[model samples]
Target: MYESFYGFTSKPFQLNPDPSFYYGSRGHRRAMAYLEYGLHQSEGFIVITGDVGAGKTTLVRSLLQRLDSSKVVAAHLVSTQIDADDILRLVAAAFGLPAKNVEKADLLLQLETFLVKLTAAGKRALLIVDEAQNLTPRAVEELRMLSNFQLEDHALLQSFLVGQPEFRQTMQSEHMQQLRQRVIASYHLGPLDLAETRAYVEHRLGCVGWKGDPRIEASAFDVIHAASGGIPRRINTLCDRVLLAGFLSEKHGLTASDVDNVVTEMREESGPERSVTPINAMPGLDSSALARLMADPAAARRLAEVAAGYQASRLEARVEQLEKVICALLGLGANTTDGADQDKERRHAG
Candidate 1:
């Protein structure tokens, strides 16, 4: 909604990780450098640990974007507390192989064959496992074993492990000694600092063609960093809500107070359970009416159309304002030229 009002081509503060919007803060840059070093070695495990919402996934996406698909075959998996055998199957599936009901031996054989084929085609295989903290010791061991697969002296498969900070603790366990031995590079991604936080917000907004509409005050940035603790996802959530608030209030500039209001509202909504009725639970909203809306396809379509129409109207208003400003400036220039011409004529007559 605010995207149109702010003249953005796309939603900049979206939650999903998009490689195109990656911001290379100090920590992220060091992480990327370690990842690049891992790629150059082309063997062993590269462990990247970070706090929740520290942009680990975004960093991985950015790395994948820079890779040459023809030379690199990459597979990604988010761990689900699966056992060792299940993890092997998941890896096989990530590589586009059928793993259903396959025996453990067969799964390993299939994976080896696939990796060998990729190697023969002059492509290296990169396996990225996210949420590694959820993986049991056995599952992690399976990954370590897979890293042992090689052709002659060159390793066929390289693994990159990404997870929350607890994963670093997991790696220190006695059971993880072998896996630790295979790690060639490791880095801990940290939250953005104050300066980086400001840069990060500007970078994302700039990506969507933000031209300072709903201009944000410097103090607002400080408030956002304080509220979000410099976490990328938290910052996105706060900024998105703040922008919505600005739109509703018809504000062309945002202050720290705007951010504080939104943060307070969000906290209240997420606070402890209360006896009072929820604000969204309108008195007239009957169960039947809600069920009908949910069941009816046409109702959903109409709701979408209504939303689109509202956004279109907002964009139209903004465009009209811009046009008016441009025309006024042009008229002023014309008046100045006419005044100069009149003065010249008076001088000639004299």
Candidate 2:
């Protein structure tokens, strides 16, 4: 909404993980290096774990964007607490193979056949499992077994596991010894520092063609870094709202005070106190008016209706985003095709 006001070509602070806007902060660079090292080794598990909004997914997307499709075929899956059997099926489905209602043995056979075919075609198969923290021990074991698929001395498939910080602890457990032994590389992604935070914001802004029209004050960067705890997603949320607040107030430059106000409003919106209010307790409502509304059954019904509508709107938006992610994971969208083709197009356009 504020794009035109700021002369941006697109929304700079979107929460979605877009590879084009990826910023290689210090920690991200090391993580990427580990991932590249894992790819070079090409026959074991590569694990990356981070906090909820530390940009793990974006890092993976950036790696995928740079891959040479002629040499590698990649499949991505987002875990949802699936069991061991379901994990196999999900992996099969990720590679565009039919998996529904298939027996475990059949699913494994199909996946193996597919991987072998890719290997024959001179391409290695890569499986990226995001949100791996939700996977059951049995499910993870199934993944390890898949990694054991080999033609002679060559491994047919490689796996990259990405998840929240707890997944690292999960990997350290006694039950995960076999999986641990197979891990060739692992990196813990940390949040950006203050300087990286400033760079990150500027990087995203620059991607959308920002030319300093809506200038962000130096103090504002500190305020954002503190409020967002240097987490990329949190910073995106805070900055997006701050920009919107600036646009609403017709201010071309953002100050720390603007960020503080937006943060307060966000907290108030999410706070329990905002969820319900008695008619008499509502601010700016006179005692007599409150009494009149409390006495009128129609007024109470209208208020309930309004509240229900608001809740429904919020649910609808959440559902929409979930649907988009599901479609992307399933490769059901045109934009979700093989990364190689998209990368080629992106480079050609550039």
Candidate 3:
């Protein structure tokens, strides 16, 4: 909603990771270097671990954007809790091979043949397993066994494992010795610092052609960094809210106190499911303007006029109801008089 107000061509703070808006912080650069190095080596496992929303998937997306699909047939898999045997089927399916209703031996043979064909054609197979922390030890071991596929001393498939921090613990298991020995590179992604947080926000805004219509004060960035703890996702969430608040208020620029008000409103909204601005939000007036409007003489008089109009409507309705009651009472009295007059005329005739 605020995107239009800010004249942005696109939403700058969306939660979905878009490699187009990928910002290279210090840590991300190092992690990307490792991933690139792994791609070059074309063997063994490349493990990447990070907290949720720490740009892990963004890194992968960025890498894929730069990949040479002619030489490498890449398959991306989001890991599930399937068993050892099922993992092989999943891998096959990812590479466009038939996985359903096929026997395990046949499935393995088909995958091996596909890889061998790719190798003979002067191509390689690359697999990226996402959310790999969910994989059981047996499932992981199966991945390692697939790495054993060899074509004349050259590995057939190279795998990249991306998961949350818990995957590191999974790799530490004693049963994982064989897999550990085969790991070519591993890196843990961390959150941005305050300086990087500011840079990231600006980078995303710049992506959408930000011209500073709603100029953000420097102190506002500080508030955002502190509230979001320098996490990319959290910063996105808070900054999006702040922009909306500013747009609703018709603000040309935002201040630190404005950010604080938005933060407090977010906290207060925990009670009920509420929207930032009500559906009937009006131009030149917003929720935050109530106090100021009440203080100003002109605005106060306008409000008083509105209140007076409402009271006048109620009074007019009451008067109309009283008039109807009076008419009903007058009609009953006339009917009684007519009945008496008729009875007297009958007596005289008798």
Candidate 4:
């Protein structure tokens, strides 16, 4: 809603998965490297785990988009809660084989033939199951069985299991010893740091053709970092709401005060402790202390620049404290000016 007002060609904070907005934080880049390596080596099973909204899906989407078409056949399965037999049918359907009403034996034969054909044609097949945590024991077992399809010396079909953190727990279960052993490579996507959070915001904005320096107060950015814990989806949600609030008030830039209001509103709507900004107010920390940095354009710019270069966790902590103090001082200045204005108004009325 605030796109035009902010001079953006498209929405900067969309929830949809877009590779253009993918920020390669250390964890993300490492995961992608693992994915790329797995694809090249024809690894048996690649497992990727992360917390909810940690961009697992986005990473997978980006990986698939870069797959070598001439040498690899990639099939993505987003539904994983089906029974073992249905899992077979889903895999069959993904490769354009006869799946509906087909017997298990018939489906397996068809799949094996397809894999053999792909191998003969100088290509390999990839089966990517997203949300694998939702898969039942039977389904996971079936997936393990499917991994058995191999040539004399090489695996024909490579499988990737990607899901939220629970998927890791599921894999680590004693019952899944076989499956766990089969995972040739695995990675857990971690949260982006504060510097990454800033770049993440800017990268998404740039992707949507935002050329103007859309002002988000420094204090507001810190609130976003703390609230979102540097998760992309949470950042997007807060930003979208913040932009809407700006639009409703006919403003072009977002102030620290605006972010404070949005954070409070989010806390009230959602449960008090949820990390993801609630669709409604959830309990959120006050970020008004960052306002002073935002009031001065140069200082805000310098803070952003310094944050970009800051790589140590300890140093970041110190800088964050300094930023808060500056904001508090600025707040005091504003309060004093406001008090002076009120005194003048009282004298005139008297």
The CA lDDT of each predicted structure is: 0.77, 0.77, 0.75, 0.74
What lDDT tens digits, residue by residue, belong to model 1 across residues 48-141?
9998788999999999999999999999898978788699999999999999999999999999999999999999999999889899889999
Q: Write the per-residue lDDT of candidate 3 for residues 181-262, one digit (tens) a residue.
A: 9999999987676567779999999999999878988666655654554567767777888888888999979986787687
Judged by whole-model lDDT over C-alpha atoms, candidate 2 comes out at 0.77
Give the better candidate number (2 or 4) by lDDT: 2
Task: List runs of model 3 lying over 4 Å from the truth.
Answer: 270-350
TM-score for all predictions? 0.77, 0.76, 0.75, 0.78
Clashing pairs in 1: none
Worst 10 residues of 1 by lDDT: 274-283
- Model 1 TM-score relative to the real fold: 0.77
Best by TM-score: 4
Residue by residue across 239-329, what tens digits does model 2's lDDT show?
8989999999999999766886886687568664332212222222233432333233344333332322223235434323333433333
Q: Give the TM-score of candidate 3.
A: 0.75
The model with the greater lDDT, 1 or 4, is 1
* Model 1 ranges with Cα > 4 A deviation: 272-350
**Structural RMSD, model 3:** 21.2
lDDT of 4 at 80: 49
For candidate 3, the per-residue lDDT at 344 reads: 45
